[model samples]
Target: MAVSARRGAPLTLEEISSVALRLIDEGGMEGLSMRKLAAELNVNPMSLYHHVASKEALIGLICATAAHHVQLPPDDGSPWQEQLRELALAYYRHVRAHQSLWTYLQNHPEAVADRQMSIWQALYRILRLAGVPESELRRTSDVLHAFVTGFVVAETRGHLPDDPDEISRDFDTAIRLIIHGLAGFSS
Candidate 1:
């Protein structure tokens, strides 16, 4: 973690991602550019290429770094329904906290699949444990993921209740509904 004298320190991948995340937070996905990031880091634009191959790669890195902050609920023999609720709430909080990055990642599902494989796998396992048939697991996962993401997006954007408690209540209601729906399809 030695700081370089140039630009107050040489850029590390972690630093790059941090600055990029900030850029995204402040300016939205369209605002982040290699030149802008390099300027922010006090380095030549080309220097960014040494760390990241392209803007898309940098975005993936930013998303992956953000994903690391999301805490997946542990499988501790809890009821599958409770476990899924925990997972959905955790994911909702994470996306709400990083709305811009999450929104950007939405357009690039392949990148998300590549970088956030662990999170995806965890969600898949939870759905399987809830007795989602093998044939329906993928669809169920997609539906649940979309629902959680869409709910948070709406809440964060003020489309939902302004009160935190109300939002939480609504979120819980939605989760229970989805879980109940899944129960109907479970073998």
Candidate 2:
């Protein structure tokens, strides 16, 4: 039973990514061993090397997929404040959906992937939509991201004990607070 006898064709990158994502979902980033992933896909580990190269590359692909999910919609007629709020919420949703991987990313993103560039690009889009200058955008973006990540981590741990909906309400309140604070910047 040789590898060629199984499929007679190489697994495409998309297929590899899908399977890897499944492995990550089932078992957090730490559990995604190359051997286990290969076993799950019924493919040889060597075959994976041809597609992903390493676990870090696979993680990067996963992060990119997550980042794409939060890409902002076209400007349309939405107000900049509305756009910022939406962007923040969308990013929070992504972190919640991938909570375990998100923690892994926060701790060791460099080890897992080359995801920073794509993530920054996405954030830049949101900031530009909000009319934020590049110089101010970086710091403002960092604070917003810290807030989203911290909020997600806090929510998952049941940090706020009030109404279950309090989390969403609190997040909305936070967005409004930041917008008010930045109002004096004049663009």
What are the candidates' C-alpha RMSDs?
2.7, 3.1
- Candidate 1 regions exceeding 4 Å error are 1-10, 108-110, 156-158, 185-187
Error of 2 at 133 (Å): 2.3
lDDT of 2 by residue, 1-187 (tens): 2343466766666666667666776778866888987777777787778767688888777666657667564567776677677777777677766777788888984654442565566667766766677788878877876776777777777886547588789888888986776565654
Off by over 4 Å in 2: 1-4, 111-119, 162-164
- Cα-lDDT of candidate 1: 0.80
Tens-place lDDT per residue, model 1, 46-129, is 878888889888888887887776788887988888888888887888777777887877777776776236677778888888
Q: lDDT of all the models against the reference?
A: 0.80, 0.70
Output the lDDT of residue 165, model 2: 81
